[model samples]
Target: MPDNVLENVGEEYEFEFVDVQSTPVVINSLGSDSADVGLLAYSSLANAIQNEMIPGGQSVIAPLTYDGPRYADTYNSTSGSSITDINGLDGNTLGVNGVGSAIDIAARVVLTRNDIDLDNVEFREVSFGAMPSTLSEGRVDVGTFIQPFFEMNSDDLQTVFDTTDAFGSFLKIFVTARDDFIDENDDAIRAFLGDLWTGIEWWKDDDNSETRLDIAEEVVELPRDLLEALVQTDRGYYHGEDGLAIDPEWLQKPIDGMAEVGFLDEEIDMSEYVDNSYLPEEANTEPTIE
Candidate 1:
């Protein structure tokens, strides 16, 4: 996440990225223990959605996904390889950075979608950065992943499918803030939300263009050229095939799936959790995040 989300909300309030990609459940479990909002990959967020674990009785925004014009470093979509089919992973241990991380939920989503019983498989939590090795070492059949890690490991593994294959599209890295926060500072909330789009735009096709690489370097400590490949490779932010607009339908399906899997304790309506009022009503139709 950009510093703006944390540092520029207003005079006093602030927020920042938590790197919840590692042990997301730990972070989610810590809700209100530390910060008011949580940043989760669409897949990891699936667990919360599945379990109805959001702060209020609603769902968080689903992150966007897209087919890049360039090559993605992720595994093969239809190719016959280690994960030739979903069943290929049956009984095979799966790798995730953390138990509650998005990769875990996303991988589970794929397995459940394929009717694979998760009880029969094991989810080995490792560093998201090290998942590729877990697979190469023959420790797991496939690795659950996000950008860079997903791309970085493409050399050794083949994706049975990606966000589209698993969930019809990539899940959103949603912002889950308290209802009180939204209600108390509607204007600040709107400003923060607008900055989110603008920040994403800077990451995505910005003319300055180093934002994505810089993110990789800052977050992953990768070299500039290496970071560029990590971002520019067939990975990075969404501009989904259909377009970049947020898709509620895309979110609903996965949330329903999470509920079916016993991740959620009760049935909750999406309407209760989401309030799109912060997004410019007219700007919701834009193709990219900004």
Candidate 2:
């Protein structure tokens, strides 16, 4: 998508894409002025706010995606485990990418929604790459796993619940910038949003699926079949249909949920962490795409 956008807007602007593995690191990098813009899960944004990494006036400005249930499943090893569902997770150890990560917030929300007590469940820090091994070794009874790990270890795991089942469709991630950056580079930021929105629209079009898969294969070096399967399963990708504009009201679910699960001290004003003035008024109406 970046390549496609650059092909059209290269003369106007250029962006460097860096892969910061986790949300905490992403927020830290943003706080230290390492990057002008960063994408983080909505809950992670809340975490950053509570941690004071994002000050009073700085905030995210655009929506990156709305996630579905294709990935991010709670699983238990198939070895005589009694944890068949969220309710059965009591007294079980759940492995997560981090203690206060997006998955942790989701798990807590899901468990609480079902009246499942969280005190009995232990959340262990396990890396994404190490999840399959952790589950396979019986180190953790329940683990929150996302693709392609979920897909790879389905045979050895039992499905407990999916994130969507806990919380319905919600705003997933957003593009954020510090207050000073947003103030000093308004025009550049708008242009970047315009270009990014156009790229998102291009990628969402069914006609470009093959081209997108080809690009994904080349960039990530994953097997073409896996890439094909991702697009087919409605894997959690960015939503370009919304012109990338953010909705503060929708974000309250994750933020409130985070507090409900004790990840945050209390519910925060979602508006403080979001500014949608730079986005197009209408979804899919980016001028660059036109």
Count: clashes, candidate 1: 16
On TM-score, the candidate that comes out on top is 2
Which sections of candidate 1 miss by over 4 Å? 1-30, 41-83, 98-101, 112-119, 211-216, 232-234, 239-245, 286-290
Candidate 2 displacement at residue 54 in angstroms: 3.3
**Candidate 2 lowest-lDDT run of ten:** 281-290
Error of 2 at 145 (Å): 1.3
Per-residue lDDT of candidate 2, residues 47-149 (tens digit): 7777788553457777765655334445555546777878778788889888777777888888888887888888899988898888778898887777767
Off by over 4 Å in 2: 1-4, 7-9, 69-81, 238-243, 281-290
Q: Compared with the true structure, what per-residue lDDT tens digits does model 1 show for residues 113-180?
A: 78889888787776666666666676766666666665555565566655455445433455555555
Worst lDDT 10-window in candidate 1: 70-79
lDDT of each: 0.55, 0.72
Give the Cα RMSD of candidate 2.
3.8
**How many clashes show up per model?**
16, 0
Model 2, TM vs. native = 0.86
Judge candidate 2 against the unseen true structure and give its global Cα lDDT, from 0 to 1: 0.72
RMSD of 1: 4.9
